[model samples]
Target: MKNNRFLSILFICLLLAVGVSAQNTVKTSVPDTIIIPVVPDSDTIGIARVRNELAAAKLNEANMRMEIELLKYQADAADSLKQAKQMQRIDSLRALTPGVPVVVTGDTLFYLYAKRGGYTPQQRAQMDADAIEELGKRFNLNPDSVYIESTDIVTDIMYGNKVIVSFTDQDGLWANCSRDQLAAKERQVIVQKLKELKEEHSAWQLGKRILYFILVLAGQYLLFWLTSWLYRKLKVRIQKLKDTKLKPISIQNYQLLDTQKQVNLLIFLANIGRYVVMLLQLLITVPLLFSIFPQTKDLAYTIFSYIWNPVKSIFWGIVEYIPNLFTIIIIYYAVKYLVKGLRYLATEIDSGHLKITGFYPDWALPTFHIFRFLLYAFMIAMIYPYLPGADSDIFKGISVFVGLIVSLGSSTVIGNIMAGLVITYMRPFKLGDRIKLNDTTGNVIEKTALVTRIKTPKNELVTIPNSFIMSSHTVNYSSSARTYGLIIHTEVSIGYDVPWRKVHQLLIDSALATEGVSADPEPFVLETSLQDWYPVYQINAYIKEADKLTQIHSDLLQNIQDKFAEADVEIMSPHYMAMRDGNESTIPKEDIKPQTTGTGSTKPA
Candidate 1:
């Protein structure tokens, strides 16, 4: 009986050991085949075979967890239903082969697959954005509360313990980045965007912005009123200055600016002050108003840039051009001093204080002017490159345009200028000279670079262009009148019956009697022509004063008429056709006294 009981206990102990070993085998063993109901039969067979082989190989616990995490990341990251379906297919394939290695790659966020679960990168990004928006809405969570948790196998973006998004090694491999690194970066972007939205919608921030806007509006109104008041004050001050202290400026006896001009200038300045005040007010108000709101802060900066940028550039440009400005100043002063010296020399020459061998006194002023113009032009050329913006395309273009206009319009002006220069050098006439040009006889009043002005004896003022003067014939009467007196001549007709000796004596006696006729030179008479019935007698006399020629000629004729009449000569200036009786003669009957007969008889009675 004891032996039988011992045998039974041993058998039961063996059976229990076998059962425990079988349970252990079942727990550790891997299936050689896997069947998938969702996949196609052919694909399923191949996938199952591969999966069975991997299971038989028995991958480590960590690797299996990584694979599961990768599959879940792909499924969650899908953007569309098609993408989800594709991700499901991929996950099924991955589950079939658990130990397969996955790649994740990106600098910031890793992609699990090249196609991102059949969705493009852009689509996936948009989906991620949508998910973040939904998470924010659902949790009503502040972006500040959102955070990321990273581990060796997976990374999770959380909003207060709620997983908003996740990343895995597969995502890291797709993005060419570490999983934790990508998740952290994603967390930062989402948090920043959500924070912006929250701040934008926050009632406190909105109220603060509104308060700033109202203050800015009030400030703008105050600025406007202040500027207006200041502008009025400035106008009053400017008017006062114009009336009292800043009256028309005069130099010596000449008025440089008249009263009207001064008033106009003051008014213009006042207007400018008003406009500037208004502009300043606008410039200040606009930027401030825009800057009061967050939405328009960037716009405020943009508007400010419109005004500030040019001013900044100009300020810096001026700073940078300081050296060039100094160079220009030196050139200007040097040219100015040199021109001043030249002008002094020219003045001396013109005034006859300094004499040059080949240069005429009249040419001094014009030559100086020409030299000054050339020197100024040369200085301008030298200083042009040093001018701010001189090298710029706009400046060059303006220069070209101006040059073209000058060249086209200055042809006649240049011609006149050249003629004036020629006339100066030729010395045809000087100022105050009595000259006859064309048909106009006048005294030269003024000579300029472009024109000559003359005052005629009738007090008529005439301005003739220098070019016209150069082209016309010029007769200068006063040029030699000082050295040799100008001649005055008159002619009279006498009857041929008169004795030539008597006529000559009468003419000489009449010329001698005329006033203003130089007695030293003496007056003379000539029988110029013998007509059919009369002889033309010419009386010539010299007068020292050319201006007195008219008066002298009139006096000479009066003296001749009186002398001929006193001599009782028959002055037959016109031809006489008469039927003469024996007692009648060419002499006036009244002037002819009847001869006193010896018998004292009245012959006519």
Candidate 2:
């Protein structure tokens, strides 16, 4: 852009200087009568002589006017010829080069400004021929003797309104070269030098570019291979250490962690090493690329500047021995095992073997989880600053971006996490407790930071978010020791044709006969509703062993069905058909109507 501006300015100055020089060199023709001085021999002009001279000058001016008119006609004829020749030359240039530029005199400012050099041979030859012809016709100069340097057409006001043609020599004999020709020659020389320089440097540049590209590719491959090798070697070494009992398993009976800790440690180390290698590889390759390709200097410098602050701090910190970052990794693994051990101890307590007298049972579990969380959080805090990406602006920006993404896309997830926290503090239920949440009833199997798992009575396991359990109504059957114990209640409807007292007696007998029913509580039955076609009865049985509620419920239902079958009483489910008038006798008025109670209706027959 700057080079273009300088060329534009230089061209304008050359044009202005040519215009001023042309104005100064303009020649005017004069006759002999007009050339004589106005004064006579007295050192002043005599009027009579001056008057005689003026009359002669007037006669001479008349003749000069005729000659000027003839010259104007000739100049006009030359200009017309020049224009026609210029058009022919332009057409030839276009035919030869198609889109190349050919500037002509008398063109508009826009065209003149846009024109450039490097005209074709055909165009230059045609222009030179037409110029010679025009000059010979107008100036009476020999076509062979007139070597036209350049031609310019300008408006001539002095000669009755017509265009005038001017020309100069190509050599120093009759004239010097024109400003435009000198500029064209200078441009050609510079272009040739630039081409030579580019060719001179080409081989060296191409080799350097290829070498740098290969080096970068090789560096990337080497880094990947090294990390992969390190990971595999670390895994094998860990297995060997485990076999030799050099790495002891601190966690006991935890099915998920059977020598898995060592593998986890190895994986974590490999990840750190991989990122370090990537950073180093980039550091080396980036500068090499810029050195080989200097045109991309700004691009490489910009990238380096953006990363320098973050990477510099980390590299220098490590070099300064600012408490070896690997120590944080060691501490993290140590704390992880310690927590696992503590959890193992807790499970031992749950087995009814490791009992602690006078210990607050509810406090132990949440406290253990909190301690484990804090310990891990501290370890992460110690290690975060040392990680490569953590100190980067892009990483910081990514963190905010990730936070926004989580907030927008994971509202339910965050809510569930908060719900888990609430559930932990609320203590609605714990592992091994039979509970119902979100219409699912099961024994609590495991509770984690994010979700709770339950094993249903059918032996199917379900995972529910802790947040959902906290938000919904949860019935924890094992929350409190069964004071009145658990009651398994069931409802049934019998046809109105059966006697209400007989139905009540049947349900009470069925409940008492069921296994796991409490003897002291005694079974009870109630008439709940009297519908148009059936009477509804509810049976309630309290069981001391709440854990056996499923078995007791099944037994109770079986006993009720057996008793009903023996009595020949029909059960009235939603699908039971009502007897038509022709199929069976109509229900009695007293059986259909509910019995009267104290200001309310009671169940009827």
Candidate 3:
């Protein structure tokens, strides 16, 4: 009766709640206003009135807009009229100036000079003939006498003002006198000794060429001898000095000799000397040889122009490209050095010999990797413009193709690199850590861009991609192994007949007997399950040595078997039907006694 009353009260309360919720929802809603206020015949009266007012407003707005547009057009027309008037005034002013030219229309000085000094070919010829006639008239010295003589006229101006005109008769006055004097001298000398140089022109050429060749050969030999002598003497002195310095150290303390270092220093000095000599020779000999040997000057100029011009062009091109290239390279090196330094510092800190207190431990490694990726990407961008033919379509195509290829093929590489960086910053494990990722269990030997190398317990190297390591489940046995120690657990099955307490005792004893097992942690035995055939037991103990894990596990299992044998505990396994039966029975026979005389008795019957 009390339960029924309670149920009835709950049902009544639920009903009252639902009813009150519905009533409140209805009261909060807006009320309808169908009969509040009415403007009768809205379509005929109200809409018509609104339409009439809208039309009037639109007409007024249209008139105002048209007036505004007309005013704007009038303003623009006035501006154009003013511009035209101003242009006319400017033209009138320019027309008034003849010599005082307008600045915008004035000719340059070079043009004026060309106009004043230049003449057409016909005008020049006429001037020459007139000047020649005037020169003949002046030379004849009779003002009324008409004279004509062929002559050449030269014109020049001095000091920007004075003009000098000269005319010389084209007759052999000076040329005749000079030739006559040369002929007289030659005739006087021809009687004693005369050779026909024209007849022996080829032989003379050959002789001259041979003399030049001999001189060149002598000069080359002398230069070679001098250079060779200098080289020999300097090399001998350098060798003596080197021997003097190195011999004592080598004989007394060979370990401290550092001969390779000395050799490197010597090589550097030698290279400096060699470059200096080559530069000096090139500076002096090239110009001197071209200047002295005019015969070969054109060839030398052609060769040098062909070689040095391109070299200089290429050098200037390199100079222009270097700033951007160097910037990218500097950024790359900076990132590389930063990452390397961070790793070094991290290693030092982790080894317990160094500590950077108050530092944000998480920021260093991630920042380094970000800087690395950004710098390398920036370098690629900056270097693109400097590459030869980079502006061409072929280069663009190749660049795009390479970008696509890198994007497609480098997914794993990029993922691994990022994973390595992530691992460094997140610190799931460190070097020398015994970890299990997926199925590979090993100690972390090295971490690189693409993969992490681990040394397994079997002394084999296992290289796992960083992507795999990063994405998979990682069991870091050594992350907290030093503190909690690593739990070495093994599963065993025992027959159900053995008591659970006795099985637990045997497991604990076996784990305790195993080598490298920790005692303070104590051995533990877990009764994992009761199966149809056997009970499953897990023996667990803390073990420290990762390298000897397999040996320790083997020893542990052997110890468990021995311990269970001593405890007389039967380890359970699958049943065998043959072993289960007590006696042997043949197929198609059912408990028949041995009867050898059956056939003989039937025959007698």
Candidate 4:
């Protein structure tokens, strides 16, 4: 009870001191001089003025005494009931004053400041907030040592005499309440909040956090298991589908894809499903786990933003590109139909049904392909700008890189294409035509923009680049074989002793005996050279079938040998040097037998 009385006395003294300080703050600009009339009785006038001054001083003293006495009486009677009444008065004052919020430790406390106070509501609120924050920090460091104290001049919320916050007359006026009263209330709230914070750091709270972390981990594990189960089920379903329903898809009688390809596609789809499920699980799990902890909660939001922002951007980008996509589709189908029309024309021309005066039939397909390529390229060029991100630096850089690569590597390809074009227009040879280029003699089997393939007489397949073929000379045997038979020639050497007329007759007979040789154009023999050892006879035969030239040549040589042998003629074409007895002849002994004729003349067999 004595302690309560002392506290009350201290609080009242603090209030009285605040009032005195507020009174001292008042400024006076008026002069202290007073003029008095001195016409008659100057002493009486001076005395009357002195008495008036005394009376005024006494009245002012009496008013001050009355105020002090009222304060003492209120302080003495400041029990629970009187304090409640005072609080009511404070509440009424607050209703009239402007309220400003003072924020401390994330909590808001209202403060009211009166108009008569020098401080504005905002200034008072700011000051109170700063002081409270400082007090909170100090309370956090040493909560037990912090207390509120009232002195004769001021009330302070202090930590060992170091004032955390002070309340004076100006503060009371600004708050529109008793300074000590407001300070005490603020101190109690701040201390209570600090104690709550300390309690939150206790071992029990730590245990609770640990338990929550364990539960979260268990939940994440369960989610992982569920995700895995779902993926496995999906994969199994896909596998079963692949085994049963997903057979090889075919077009008409042709197999468009085989069973292996179907299985691979199913496996690919299953893998995609598995990975998608895993990714979704990871995304959900990571953010959830991060949100479970205060330290990583912000990071969780950041991570979500990192993925979501790009996904959102891509979704919007695709939505915005819908018109461009439609344009691209229109252009693509337009080019496709145009190419189809060109292909139909090419086919007709290639089949000789469509004739153009200047356009060769062989050029139709290749020209169509070339034109189609150019059209597609033009379509792509037209659509390039409308593509999403086409103007971005990365897209431009990739395009430039691709262009550079093509330009650097296409030199040989360009040459081949050009040579193929030239070869096509030149009409050197067509497919299945027997032709000879340099030393290679063959029938053309295939021709493309890059290379020409030939099947040689030896059944060897030879592929020659179009550029190489363009640079070499070519001889086409089948070109004129149909209209004018191609000539097949073979050379034979014979001893001068054998008559040239007889040799020519023998060569012509051999050529005529060859099956592929044309009978209409009679075979002829030319005495190409008169050498020292023998004469060179070239037998020229017309053959309607150029492809059978090799077989016919072989047959002709056999026929020549058989004819020469039958006539008992020795074929010593290359040079014959032999030591012969006087009776020995070049003919076979059996053929050298003598026979008697009708006139009794002897003849060699």
Candidate 5:
């Protein structure tokens, strides 16, 4: 672009200089009429007067011709100045904005500024250049036949009935000229450019171009090979350096990356650089090859544009998006710090360092997570407009698509999450609580957003979904065990011979002897039912450790049997009692020996 501007300035200066020199050189050719002596009455003086008048008239005639030629020179110089000024103005406009130059084989004939119909200036310019190039490929293209046809609205520059370009008033306005002049000037340029292209594309010129094409391809291949070879050598050298020179990357004694990773990173960077070299080679080589052939000359520029246009668009897009990018960053940080503060508050609440009215401390962390998610979501909504291409159809479409997929596929997941949230706030059973749900009794070990895990007394693990847990009933033995002890109860039937009071006393004694049973809330026995053969006695004990309820009950039962046996109470089940009136006690009397008395009968003394 700078080179084009310099050439324009040089051209205008040269034209102005020529005009000034021509104006200085201008001189009126007719000299003052020569003065002569008056003729005498004699024939010699009369003839001298007559010859002098004729010579003076002839000089006057010659001067008239010189004046006419000088006037024509002045008119030509004025036209030249006008042309130079107009070109200078057009060049100025071209430099101010983007304009496509009509280039043919490295020479820029002119730039196209105005777009007609659907074609942009760049596309129009390329089409025209391509037409001209294609015209040169013809065997019998006549430059003399190239002419300009001016109409009321447009002027067409044609080459043998083919319209090279249709110039409109807009183009003339851009050039600071009438449509007719623009067309005429451009027609000459096109003809001359086409002639040059024809000569360059001649057989001998084509042979040289082909040679140059081959050389470029060979050079590109060699560069690619050399790049690969050099990269392999660097890869090996990096590996060697890992053992010999490279140490682990660390920050203040903490290893961030090991030596092997550093070597790998070096090799990765080298590989990327190699790829970039290959890409650069292609970018240069492909365009060169295309420009080498006149037929593909436009293609060279088209390919260049293919790469350049996107790069320019991306660069400008980033530049234009800087303010919005800043806005997004600001929003992100604002929300981030807000959430950080919230997390700290939640931590204080969970640790019981802080408290809120009617808010349970256990609900703190999950509530923070919920609020954090909502805050981040709101931040995204606020920043959406500031995101580059966020308003584009593709971005919106993709968002909608992902939303649809989530809605369709994650119904169960969403349900479980909601249930988990409810369970958290409801304070159902927390970790390490002994709970029973749907006949599965176990101690809660883990709780998550999706499921709650428990380990049964038998050490069997059970995973119940939050949704399922929400719908079913739950019994939490450990929830109230510490505040109000859990009542551990069992039933046993004894014969009617044992008085209800005595039976109750024995049961209470056994329960109070149990390890996990609390004696402060003294053990109690309930006579649940009295049947014809036996009475059912229920022994209940208060226990702080609900988790040891099973083991405590087992020990209580064993203690009950031992206490009844020590008293010789003969605690008999209804199934074992045959004769209620006269039967030896089921408990054997210690220190009583059995002796034989006549027949094979044993008796206790």
Candidate 6:
């Protein structure tokens, strides 16, 4: 503006200087160039010279006007250059001037360089930002409400009653633009930002979001319904499969999991899948719903991050666990195959196909089981580190607690297992072997790590703890019956009147006549005890079958009675001796004497 004023004053000075130069030129000019006309003799020559002089004067006047215009053009050029330099200087000052950015939705629209006396540029920028934010928050507001007002010093870019920002001449100077131009530009920017904010949160946009949300919910419900329906269908199919495809999972003769347990496991897995899918749908839908509204847009992202963080962590945990999982799988399979091979070897040995010296076939399976248990324990120890959350205190704590419980509660059980192992290698008895343990004599039927079951001769089942068996004596009669023959012996009392040789011969003959008696190893009789009135005659006979000991003994006693009755050799009893020698009543007629008394009922006599 000062440059403009200077240019105007220079134009006025040029006009005055031109007027003075013209007057001076008029004063300095020769009076009609009389000296030039003197050389002209003729009137025609004088008239031609005068016309030439007038042409010269017009030419000189045109040249003087050209000089004046040239001088003015130079002054204008100087002023333009000076103004450009001042503009450059202002631009440099503006570059050095600190400004606060007016940010909207994380984007900086412009800088606020103007500051009041009480407020810094930052504070001014905050006011502007707050105004724009308040305006944008109105979903029903229109961008056309934004307008500008020009005052003597400042231009205000306003929306309704809110001033978004204002521009002054100083501000324009800083921006290197006019006040109105800067204000208009700022207004345009603010209005455009407000329009974007309004559009984003408008009813139409919200409706679209609602539609999307509905679609998502519909899809989610559909998935849930599908999952449930599929689960029901699978349940029905599984129920049907219970009678068809599903069976108890068994290893050899041992059932690991029942058919019903398998069905329940499958159903549980299906339910878990359903919950996971529904939860995933909810995660997606809730975030999308939140994001539809501009006010909750950041909240939407926050919620998404919250929900996705765990999912992402779990996914990454699984991904990272893959290598460990593979390692565990490999270790499991290696141990499994090794155990399988050992089991095969044990089976071979147990079936008597394979034999080792001093190692009985009965020892094979139990030893294999011990080795398998150790291998499984070692496998657990090896694989524990690779398990997810293995490093967690809770996992370690649980493991320690379980181990502590087992160690504390399983003393007797462990003793039994150890005794069972010892009993197995000791080859004390096997299945179907007639054995006597403590006061229980029976055939061994089932043997376990903790207890052994025996079926008695009277069909009574007796379970004996292996630990107790370890401390007690066990007689395995059948152990040598197949080779040597089990001796079945019974004692009979004979009167002293009978000769020892006769008593011995009679008992031996009775044992020989009995069924199930082995004659090759002849029966023998021994005088076990000699009483005052009778002698104990013990007869021993060998039988190939030890399990039939009860039946053989019954038959031997019956045969002894018959042989003694026929031979007239009395098989004496104390009662018979008392009746015969003490002169007891021989008839019922002598012992029964009926005596009737008054008011007494006569009982059978």
Could you tell me every candidate's TM-score relative to the true structure?
Answer: 0.63, 0.38, 0.46, 0.62, 0.66, 0.60
Ranking by TM-score: 5, 1, 4, 6, 3, 2
- Candidate 6 C-alpha lDDT tens digits along 301-370: 9999998899999999999999999999999999999999999999999899988888878788788989
TM-score of model 6 relative to the true fold?
A: 0.60
Q: How close is candidate 1 to the true structure, as a TM-score?
A: 0.63
The clash tally of candidate 3 reads: 0
Give a tens-digit lDDT track for model 4, residues 1-605.
47767876797787678666644442121113333546688787888689667655765686588588867777566655565565667677765765666676457765544332477667766776776555544324666666888887677878675665566754665555677887877777667765665555556766777788788778878877887787678767766776678777789999988766876676787778767877887787777777655446678889888889999999998999899999999988998999999999999999999999999898888889899989999999988998888999999999999999999999999999999989988999999999999999999999999999999999999999999998999999998788789988888988877898998899898889889998888999898998878878999999988898899889999888766765667677657754456755565565344767899998866
Query: For residues 453-478, what per-residue lDDT tens digits would candidate 3 score against the true structure?
Result: 98888788999888887779988887
On residues 1-605, what C-alpha lDDT tens digit does candidate 2 reach at each position?
Answer: 35645765576566557655643443222333335465546634465557667665765675566557656755776665665565565555544543222222212111111121454434543453343223323322222221223345211111112211222222111112343454344334323333443543466666877787788788778877887787678767766765565443554654544456766676677778778877777786776677556456567777777778688987897776445556767877888899999887766665555778865465466667777888888877777776666879998899799879988998877787778777776778878888888788889889877899999899989998877677689887765336567777899998877788898899998888888887667788877888887878999888776567788899999888777765556678654676566764333333343546787868554
Q: Note the clash tally of each candidate.
A: 14, 1, 0, 0, 0, 0
- Candidate 5: list runs displaced more than 4 Å: 1-195, 202-204, 238-276, 578-605
Best by TM-score: 5
Query: What's the lDDT for residue 544 in model 1?
Result: 75
Q: lDDT rank, highest first?
A: 5, 6, 4, 1, 2, 3
Model 3 residue runs over 4 Å out of place are 1-217, 232-290, 293-369, 372-409, 422-428, 479-486, 495-497, 515-523, 528-534, 542-551, 568-605
Total backbone collisions, model 5:
0
Worst 10 residues of 1 by lDDT: 98-107
- What overall lDDT, based on C-alpha atoms, would model 4 receive against the true structure? 0.78
Off by over 4 Å in 6: 1-135, 139-192, 201-287, 298-311, 480-483, 578-605
Q: Considering TM-score, which of the candidate structures 1 and 5 is the better prediction for this target?
A: 5
